[model samples]
Target: MPKLKLDIASKVLRLANPLRVAGYTFETWEVIVVTLDDGARRGRGEASGIYFLGDDAANMRAAIEDVRAAVEGGLDREALRSLLPPGGARNAIDCALWELEAARSGKPVWQLAGVPQPRPVVTTFTLSADTPIEMARGAVGYVDARAIKIKLTGDLALDLQRVHAIRAARPDVWLGVDGNQGFVRDQLDALIPALVEQRVSLLEQPLARGEEAALEGLASPIPIAGDESIVSLADVTAAPSQFQIVNIKLDKCGGLTEGLLMAAEARRLGLGVMVGTMIGTSLATAPGFVLAQLCDFVDLDGATFIVEDRLPSVAYRDGTVFAGPDVWGSGRP
Candidate 1:
């Protein structure tokens, strides 16, 4: 086995504006980047830990450092699954391994994974949780976007008002809402109907993870997606009973290898898949974009919130994400 060199670093990206999600607000995106060198080739990966989920840059870096010996001794992606629990650290290392293999074999990561060619993906632009007027103003900027995802914080009246305002602003764009596990089960009855009236196409994680059983046999006006509820293959198996769609984030699942398997399994179980991401640079969104190819909804808009992105960035024109050949794992020669 060839000895591999590992490098880990952290960066804080200033957000273009304060981003308010269901539980917290952040003005900066803290990311952990990993690079591996085999003396002949180099591979790179990035991870933006889910802050609300108790993941942060420092801890992710420490996790990577914990596996220094294993990585240097030639850790492969499959071995990595057992070595590290699913989260930012595993995501970074798993993606790095894929990049390393692609560089070594002179093949794209998609080819190595037996995935079809990737094309420009149409993605959703998000409106951070805010007042109805403010969210409407945000929606105005994304008029050209095919779909817009609105963040809600469980305020039944305010959340409905925000959705209605955004719909009034951009009636032509499809609308989706992510409650981020902020809503209570009782609110869904009133909220879902109001959202449906405004033509909201999707509702994501309206209730908390453990509270998902409340959705069983409940008829919802809008299709619901499971974000917090489904993090692993086993979660995917249980998701169909609670949700019509499963939101798969690479950071949540660990990496592209597992994400791909999860998406495949979700489809086999007749659940729609949505590829999402934690706020980071194009490096983080690129791997999610690959997974987006197999998804019914694409939410890789994390880069849109950052004021600056890493070089060889993924490009967004209107709502389409274009991955260039210069980027890692782009699967382009």
Candidate 2:
């Protein structure tokens, strides 16, 4: 790898609507974008900082700066893992390395990642927590979506109402619900039945982080996914004990490299894998799109909620999403 010019910046992405969930309501998101240029080749990456862990855009930039000399001095991706903790800063730089390799090798990222031929994959469109009627209407708004993920607070009755309304409105689509770590043991036990009634196939992060033990011996008909509970490859061991599925986001796991490793680990443990995202643009979503090929479930609709997205964006067509090579993977330089 040649000594590369590194450029870092942040973008404030406004949501099309207020994204209301269990513990947070997001109207705007700040993402860090990284670009690596080596005279003839360019690579780009984006990351939605780990806000829960206080890894905001400012810190993400600072993290990059902390290791600026080593990076421009030709620090490789594997060494990068040690340079920065698994978070937005590492995710951005790691992905940029992947893309840079793609450009240098004249291969698309999928091929670089060992996927021969990648295809568009169906993804779940999400509806934020809202009144039952409003959420139902939101479901109808995703005209081409074949799958839907509904955000739910711990309010058992209201959550049930929202699911029932959406199910009634679109009985044809696959359904799932995210508690965002809003429920306790008893509350989740109470909510599972209602979700099953609505044909909800997955329950995501019902219990708060570190509460995976409470789920022991509790079997759910719907596969429970560990999102907030599992952060990166280090947290994969905790999944088999508490969840049937592990949700991998590049921002959370740090990058596509760890995301792929986490998926492989989940498979080895006989746990399912899902590719999810924070609210971001196509640049951020594209790397996750590559990782989705190995996943059982996909939820890469983060850009769909944003008011303005970059051109050459990921396309949501006929209920599936695809990002052409032009998006960010290769041919940029």
The number of the candidate with the highest lDDT is 2
Candidate 2, 114-223: lDDT as tens digits: 75567899999999999999999999988999999999999888889999999999999999999998888988767888788889998999988889899888889999
Clash count in backbone of candidate 1: 0
Name the runs in model 1 displaced over 4 angstroms. Answer: 330-333
Which residue runs does candidate 2 get wrong by more than 4 Å?
none
With candidate 1 superimposed using the best TM-score fit, by how many Å does residue 266's alpha carbon deviate from the native? 0.4
lDDT of 1 by residue, 148-187 (tens): 9999999889988999999999999989999989999888
Provide the lowest-lDDT 10-residue window in model 1.
324-333
Q: Which pairs clash in the backbone of model 2?
A: none
TM-score of each: 0.97, 0.98
lDDT of 1 at 126: 92
User: What is the C-alpha local distance difference test score of candidate 2?
Assistant: 0.91
Quote the lDDT for 124 in model 2: 96
